[model samples]
Target: MDPILLGAIFITPIAAIIIIGLIWYQKWNYTFKDLQHIKGPTPLPIVGNMSELGDPTKIFWQLFNWQIQYGNIVKGCYGMDMLLLISEPEYLEFICTSQSTLPKGIFYRYLHKWLSFGLLTSKGKKWHQRRKMITPAYHFKILEQFVEVFEKNGNILVEKLRGEVGNPSFDVNIYLTLCALDSINETAMGTSVDAQNNSNTDYIRAIKEMNRIVVDRTIQPHKHFDFLYQFTNDYKIEQKCLKILHSYTLSIIESRRQELLNNPSRFDSKYVDEFGMKKRIAFLDLLLQSTIDGKPLSNEDIREEVDTFMFEGHDTVSTCMSFWMYLISKHPEVEAKLLAEQREIFGDDPKRPTTYLDLQKMHYMEMTVKETLRLYPSVPFMMRDTLEDFTFRDLSVKKGTQILMLPFYLHRRADLYPEPEKFIPERFTAENMSKRHPFAYLAFSAGYRNCIGQKFAMIELKSTLSKVLRSFNICSAVPEHNLVIKSEIILAAGNGYKIQLKNRTW
Candidate 1:
């Protein structure tokens, strides 16, 4: 054989082997062996189940249906990526509580970058430090100070409803959103946003824009590629929202800095006067005065914390209020009972908005609110990633595997609550609550990273509902419309909830 011919033969075989090996590796790399045991719908090549997942209208129901088919713990693929959907309470508890094992998922990395290391997005030691620093701000004693703000906002809502009495139809979502915005602004930033007054504040607009962009990003298939965000419209919107939000937060911090400088005594813990009651007003003020290891919070720290609170403070509470109103409108008996409870508590005081002490007395109202959360938790699902190899039900979850815990399904488990679909507030009564698992009714989630603003949100809901129910009778404007539920960071009614407001005769 000629030398050139022999050399060609050897090189051709080597190249063929290399190509075969590369192809084999690619196929193996894309496969998920562990998920073989768990049954799910056949996923399409490349897209996997992403086509089904991207359908915003049917995604939740589709997932719920999958849960029914594949049992509580179903494994599915999304574009070559594996996801474990955990619906069982026990599994959820393990995922949520096992922070040392499971951290927030990589999908949330974008949020972490945008929002900074705040309680909602931060993980590991940083999350712990931030939570510790902020926990005291939400203690019952501190939250009590914001009762008036809640009442004022609730009263504003009532006045708005009263003005529209006999209108036969109106969209309540916008109003609820505005009420939450105003209340959060006053409580969290110590600055009045005047959202209920229809003021188009840049901060409020930006917040709304951010939510819209987030929803768009979630639903749009092409936006899933993180690198592509820079060249997309969603990125532009997100950037705009971030700018307005950050600017507003920084401006508030600067104003507070000036105020602290002008009145050094404002930071004094012993500035009590005649009544012997210490007056530490405002959320920003409290945060500013808070120190860890005797070091004041840095501006960056304040901005991140404030932004987190502001984002959460408005969205979750507002979404809950909107759903609660819709539920009450559908159930007149429940509404009547709520009204009677309100009347019994305040006793015909026309000017009496719920006081902090008064809210404490509204036990029935609390039950109603709890039940509402159980049925329509503003946050339907939460994502966590495995930080280390951990065993769940004898199966190992390797580091970096995404874990999705759906509270929506868990809340509706028939075994946990008989006839779970039935709207029964009594399920949350003290007696009934004691019999269930502590993590079963986790509307605000469970364990160390549970919602810090849960108390404030509860108080705000109770106060607002009491005032609204006391003053007006609300009924759905279009009862026939099947209201679609969608999640874009928070659960919201797809078609804005419309209600008829009638002034209460009683």
Candidate 2:
């Protein structure tokens, strides 16, 4: 072979490589110019900033550090997707109150299969119609019926704590979660899951597993693509989980649909039983009768709303209440205040169940719950995609950019809340809250797309906590098991909510 021929072959390939590299650099520069002013951590070639966010358990805190080091509107990446995490109050208010009605950001794509076009995941006309129809289901009259469910479930929880009264400490997360599951299921589906008694039930297991998988998939970028995900074992497990979740939800929908045919007026209005008491109407019963564009909602459509209710209702309340138990335990003064308030409402009869009026009288507990939410919100963060370009805080965000709202850190801002890390229920007093930014505390999120079940969740939490505090005294673990907070699809405690209980002697 001639030396000239060999040189020509090697040189040609090297020249091509240079040309391709230059073309790629030019494209990257052009795209980033719109966001050129935004400051953020440097990204790697393919994974972007995912290496820094490698651990799901610590990603939220990691992002918080980035926000502090970079700025309030920290620009970063999740794999190839750009994520703009906002903590500034003005920016949060603008994004939330304006474009929130836009579809949920990319993170919700994974939830579509399980929750699917439910009020949480739906967008556009579908979301508007569904929101209109679903609003009535959570009416004061309808919600009034759920108080009985809460009390009955709360009593079961109080009775169950008897077995753990003498133990030094145990993870009470499961107890609270199952109790919530039982209560939400009874109200949402009108079926008795009795999750507290049968903790090993399939529905409960599937929900737990699905929660893990949603977080798992979010962090692992490769799983984002269905084509790539289908080849992995997690994909298989996800399918199995979906089968259990959807089948059970659908089964109850069908059962209730058939049951309604026999009664035909269950959803008409809350009817009175022979005992002259108003009967309860489950969330599912209302959805069964609802229609979209004059066509009755299909079973699939009804299941979407019911399943969404289960996730939001049970997971949101349980996580918040669990934190309250831990926070209340750590601050004995807080616990004393809570118990005193309980007495004021129930008049020394702690065993008496709470009514709607009773929940209203829980002014102190309401403030405490609000403060707990500020410290550790039920949903740690909310994600949204901008439908139109917007400018805020002198920063211009492009359309199609993903906005990750970090309520976890927003509420932690020292500038916003003095001694932000401390448990101060008074921070939520009428006077204090009025002085604060409305968007500063986003436990239930903000704006048009805020959590629809907010009132329902508050009622369940206050009633349940009132019942538990009345019967038992919750104390922190002997060795001090600190809650390792993690932001998953919902806020989660990696270490579990560990506490001891003593039978109330008052």
Candidate 3:
């Protein structure tokens, strides 16, 4: 071989080995040493505690046990990457409340391909601007207008349950989910999706498939890397789902844009209802009319928010409603008290449309929802990326570390909630709440990035449940102990929420 070629071959291999060694040292040596003080399950060589996540179906329980075994804060790893799992209320309060702890970590990136920068995944100045712009869409006044949509859907749900009355253990999940989709689409997209009417829309199916893929990816740590995940069939399926979802949202945006162009007066806020009162516009219209620093939201920007709202708005509240109904069925005394309150508010009218004032008066129902959330938060856990070097009590975390906050475990802490496993709505009464830590309960999360649609969700919950309760008495077929639960971004019962509805004789 020529002298130059021989020299190049030797040096290149040596340099490559050195580079790999340094990368390994940084990840395995330095990172592990820095977090050695924090208590957690021991990690293996390259995989770390990745396998500790074991079966995807049982991962939630494993993590819950770990949260107890390792104390409020435990350090774990996926490969050399570190994670700080937290269930402490004070620590959680700090993490959520502080302005600096806003950027979501790598996990949320999984949702980005679907959600884009629509509030849930956006960060920094862009997030702030979007938050401000979209804030008005969920305002109390705006949500008040959505009451008509909620009422229509609530009545639809009640009527649909008529045939199922006295049935033995029918799953209500599909019914509630469809009702939510219809209500949210009408309010969020300026149109009716007719999901409750059983419209076989690809968009709805895509949403369900996309959520399953996200859960699959999350539980399988090896699929975290894009390079490897790209080769998997799930990724291909996810792409197809995204196409359907995006196409649907884009079409809606185009339709609304054309409608506004043909009738400029529709863009104006002067339209009066039959009562001569100005009607509130759809969420899509609000986004179209909004300007942030002189620029209106693009179709893409508007689509992201619309898609985000569609995903977040419907399933979350619907899931909560499912549990709310199940819990009521399990506790007859609680249901009796709840029915009494509803009767007091609306009198004997089973078809009374729930108003903003009526929803506000459903105080006990709100507490029951709160207690249900404490046991089963819609979004079970949240992750945040460290923006800077951080310290927690005796432990230190470097910049770029991922933080996992577990509201599921925190809400059930024995120190905070006295019989943590019991179904007690009175635990949230004003006096009891005042005595507890403000951050002890985080049903819709907490702090700056806390759920923007919380008020809207609460109203939807009360309205839907109030309507159903007025017409039918709900009972669950499965006992609380018999229910098998799992976490998939949102908590779900593995066997489904099976219940029987009996028409109220009064």
Candidate 4:
């Protein structure tokens, strides 16, 4: 073979590829021109600032440090994509409350595998319709129905924790999460998953694995494409996990739908008892009977919403409750006040069931829970992708850019809340709270896209935490072990949420 002939074969294609690559790079790199006003670490080609973002476990704090250096509104790159992180109150207000920014970020595509285009990921008219339809399910009136479920599951948690009481320090979050799973299953589907009693189950394991794979895919750029991701091991695990989660949800939905068909009036015609309480109905029941465009929602659509909430409902409350427990253990003064409040609510019997009205009456515990959420919001960040150009001061945010609202960083801004680092529950007092910007604290997020079941979560947290405080005196392990924060899809303690419990004596 002649050298000229060999060069013609290999060099011709190589030259064409390089020419195409250069053209692609120029077009791709040109999009960040509008974001030039925002400050961030310099990005490398392809990988962008991800190399500097460091380990996934520390990405939460790495981004925080970047914010501290770059100012409130910061931008970073993952490949050619741009991500904006804002801690400024006005900016947060603009993005969260405004209709223009309602659609979730591009990464939510990952959740489509499990959550689908449910309320958590849906957009435009569909999002509006689903949200409007689902809103009634979470009304304070309906949330009251689940108070007994919370009380029962919370009580089970207390009874189960009896073994841990007066014992060595242990990861209380594991128990609390199982208890929360039980509560969500019972309240959301009108059935018991019995997660509290049997911690090791296929469904439970699938839930954990699915959350991990979702977060993993969201951050890694190459996995963003289904063409590439479908070939990976995580994708295989994701499908298996989805099978378990969806099959369980579908089975429950079918059973509940048949029950609804048998006695349609059972869901309607509210019958108030002598105690003035209506029958407890699960979130699943409401969806089964709900209509979209005046037609019944399909099983998949119903499953999307039901599974969305069920997935959203559990670990969030459990993580919040677990962190609250850890916070109280560290601050005996705060715990003392919480214990006093519990005594006032339950009086002499610490192991009493909490009515919805009773939960509403506990003020300090609610404040403490809010404070816990401030420090460690279950979803540390909420993201939005601009469908239309968005403006903040001189910055022109082009369409397709992602806006990351990190409450973990925003809630810590000194200007927003003076002494922001302190865990002072009093800051949430009505008078003190009035001094702060409304968007300054976004634990449950804000405005139209905010969490629909926030009130439901609040009631659950109050009911569960109050029960724990009433039954046991909790303390962090001796010498106060610190938690390594993992701020992924769910904010969690990389180190276990460890605590010791002593039986309560009043």
State which candidate has the highest TM-score: 4
- TM per candidate comes to 0.89, 0.93, 0.93, 0.94
Computed on alpha carbons, the lDDT of every model, listed in order, comes to 0.78, 0.85, 0.85, 0.85
Lowest summed lDDT window (length 10), candidate 1: 23-32
Q: List model 4 lDDT by residue over 372-471, tens digit each.
A: 9888889988889888876777777777777888899888888877788788999899998998889888998898898998999999999888888888
lDDT of 4 at 61: 84
Candidate 1 vs 3: which has more lDDT: 3
lDDT of 1 by residue, 1-506 (tens): 99999999999988887776565445423334544566677765455678888876777777878888887787765664557787776766777778654466655655654578777888777777778888788878778878878888888887877777878777788888899889888888888878899758787778777776765666566877778878987788788888878888899999998888898786564677568867556778877887877898887788888888888878899888888888888888888788788788878684675678888888888888888889889888877777776777745565656777778888888988899987888898899999998878778988766788888888888878788887788787777855678777788888877788887776
Residue lDDT tens for model 3, 263-373: 767666678756887755899988888888998778999999999999899889999999988888888899999989988987867676788999889999999999999
Residue 146 miss distance in model 1 (angstroms) = 0.5
Runs in model 4 lying further than 4 Å from the true structure: 1-30, 269-278
What lDDT does model 2 reach? Answer: 0.85
**Higher-ranked by TM-score: 2 or 4:** 4
Name the 10 consecutive residues with the lowest summed lDDT in model 4: 23-32
TM-score quality measure for candidate 2 = 0.93
List CA RMSD, all candidates. Answer: 4.8, 3.2, 3.4, 2.5
